[model samples]
Target: MSQKKVDAYKAEKANREKIMKKEKRVLRLEKLIALAFCIVAVVWIGFSVYSKVNEGKEEVVVNTEMDTSALDDYLSGIATDAADAE
Candidate 1:
């Protein structure tokens, strides 16, 4: 082979360990990031489920009594005024 090719091969071989270490570090960082994302997703899902479960247990109070005394009095007043006008 040519001397230039031999020198380039030797240089690459010399730096192989450094390149491997860099690759391993990048892989470890990617794993950590993925793990963190999974943990956050689980926590968010758990909170949503907890809130939904508790939401169903709450009691709602509704006022169902129909009090129409004031309306009746108002209508009576209007009727009396109309009778007086005539």
Candidate 2:
């Protein structure tokens, strides 16, 4: 084979290998970025859930001997007012 032909073939092969390497590097970088984003999203969601759970832990007090007569009277007054408005 001619020396010029051999040299051209070698150059083409080298160029193809270089392109493949670049493509592989780009793919690896994209995968890493996606993984990092997923980790951040998971942490953000976990923190949000933790905050919500903590906020829901409010204490509510109830009196066993509470009187209901005043509440009943107030509701009755409201009902009468509604009827009058109608």
Candidate 3:
């Protein structure tokens, strides 16, 4: 084959190799993005399940019915007895 034809062929081969490398890089990025989304979806699903389990059973501390007077009254008798022992 002519030297000119051989050189042209070599240039074309090099260009094709460059495009293949770029295509592989793009495919790798796509795979990474897909994996990231999968992890996010799984975490979101877990949070949803946890919230559902706590539904209606979750208690608010401020909404309690505890009476300070009753608790103090109950503890006063115990403290008095303990002091009498001393």
lDDT of each: 0.98, 0.96, 0.93
What is candidate 1's lDDT per residue for 33-63, written digit by digit as tens?
Answer: 9999999999999999999899869688988
Ranking by TM-score: 1, 3, 2
Worst 10 residues of 1 by lDDT: 54-63
Candidate 3 Cα outliers beyond 4 Å, as residue runs: 1-11, 60-86
Q: What TM-score does structure 2 among the candidates reach?
A: 0.51
Give the deviation of candidate 1 from the true structure as CA RMSD: 8.7
lDDT of 2 at 5: 98
**Winner on lDDT (1 vs 2):** 1
Compare candidates 1 and 2 on TM-score and give the better one: 1
Runs of candidate 2 with Cα error greater than 4 angstroms are 1-12, 58-86
On TM-score, the candidate that comes out on top is 1
Top candidate, metric lDDT: 1
TM-scores for all predictions: 0.61, 0.51, 0.53
- Writing each residue's lDDT as its tens digit, candidate 3 over 6-43 gives 99999989799888999999999999999999999999
Better of 2 and 3 by TM-score: 3
